[model samples]
Target: MKAWFARDYGRPDVLRLEEVAKPVPKPGEILVKVHATTVNSGDRRIRACDLPPGMKTLGRLALGWSRPRQPVLGTELSGVVEAVGQGVTRFSPGEAVYAFPGGRMGAHAEYVLLKETGPVAHLPEGVDMQTGAALCFGGTTALTFLRRGAVRAGQSMLVLGGAGAVGSAMVQLGKLAGAHVAATTSAGNLDLVRAHGADTVIDYQKTDIARLAERFEVIADTVEAMDFATAQKLLTPNGRYLAIAGTLKEMLGSLRKGPEGKRMIAGPADERIEDIVELGRLAALGQYRPHIDKIYAFTDMPAAHAHVDTGRKRGSVVVQVAQ
Candidate 1:
């Protein structure tokens, strides 16, 4: 089987495409023939070994002390079941599926084996493989924020990086959750964010976003670029700040805000399988939609990684693996 591997953690150049042995599923797992996969922010952090403080420590344990402990570096996949391991009753051969695989993180290949119990689910009959793969990270993360935070319909919500994958997902899901969604993006991607139900768009380059304020009930720091002190003013009295890329500094300030549900800080583990399933259900029912920015060939995984590394991507970027 063909796969991409990184010998050591460094850059996109460290990743190389090669022929590797196909993996068989263990009991309670299913072997998938990967059709589509995505480049997540987490994948980029792992590729360069530039993880956050806590993640860096975990990298030493799960990845490697000096280099990558696990050579493969991709997550969130949409594929078809090639074979099911014993005791896996949810799917059968040829069934279409998409999964997060969480800590497993081996979706950048022709085949990956994952447990049926994780953030994995069956693709609705109408959804394509590419969109399916894109759902795990963006879908689950947004759901977690909306669910765990103090957001309600008719409230105002702002997504700092609204044009990117996770940000766009937040815009869409935020709207679906009945909030008046606002997003930040370059002037070039304003239409992209607005198309996904964003009621307000801020061209981050043109003006100071913090100054133009309607106090928000929920402010999601998906990009982590905005300073918490300034962002605090945008929140309503009982507002919540769910930082997708929050830091220890922000967490402490949020902690100071005390019980009003003002500071809700959490890690990337914010994604849950149930949350993703709920997003899927909403998508299936036409209450939600995925607006893909572009698709790249699977062989151009390196280039795709490089593009995202620029930190100026629009909406969701996907890699078509099988087609």
Candidate 2:
């Protein structure tokens, strides 16, 4: 099996494709022949050790001190089950599946092994491998934050960096929750964000968000562009601020109560197998679709990483690992 390995953290070029021993499924696990996977912000951050301010040391301790603990640097994948281990009756060989080994990595290869009970599910019919590979990371993150904020019908919700994977998912999920959704993106992505169900789209490059008069009941910042102070002014009383990409300081602020009963929600999202199941159901119903910015060959994993590093992708950047 061929996998892209990131031995050291520096840049996209650090990734090197090499031949590695194929992994066999252990008990209660299934081995998948990967058809597609994604190079998302998580990959970029881990590959380059790009931690937010005040988090460098902690990130290093969690990830690795001098090199990555896991050389294979991918999180989600869509593939066909090639084999199933003992006692795994939930899935069979030849089934199409999507698995999110979120933070476990190792999807940037020809094959991957997933536990039968992990965050892995059948790829819904009519959803292609590319879309399946793109679904989990952003969808799960958005759903987790929305649930934490208790978003509801008729409320106004704002999504910053609305064109990125997580941001786009937030916009779509926010609308599905019946909230009046507004999003911020570059001028070129206004229509893109609107297409994802945002009722109002603001060009972040042209408009100063701090000066906007409108306030939102829930504000989800996916780009870490707005701090607690600025977001407080834009939020209605008792509103919730979702710091999806907050710095260490901002994340620690999650412990402190905001003025007037407002609150901040931060930290890593909890990945659940149920979330993957819901995303598959939504995709099958045509209610949720992951926006794919580009597709690269497996050998072009470095190029895919570079593209994601640009911070200009509208949504997911997929890599076709197999046919």
Model 1 global lDDT (CA atoms, 0 to 1) = 0.79
* Model 2 weakest 10-residue run by lDDT: 246-255
lDDT of 2 by residue, 66-155 (tens): 999998988999999999999999999999999999999889999999999988999989999999999999999999999989999999
Candidate 1 residue lDDT tens string, 1-323: 99888778877888899998888888998899999988877788778887665456755677788777777777788899999889999999999888887556888899998878877788887878877888767777778777778578898998888887778888988887789998898888998888888999999899788887478888888887576566677877777878778655555565566455466555545657777787667767766666666688989998888887887767566888997
TM-score for each prediction? 0.93, 0.99
Worst 10 residues of 1 by lDDT: 258-267
Per-model CA lDDT versus the true structure = 0.79, 0.92
Q: If candidate 2 were superposed on the true structure by all CA atoms, what would the RMSD be?
A: 0.8
- Which pairs of residues have clashing backbones in candidate 2? none
* TM-score (C-alpha) between model 2 and the true structure: 0.99
What pairs collide in candidate 1?
Answer: 63-69, 163-315
User: Which candidate ranks first by lDDT, i.e. highest?
Assistant: 2
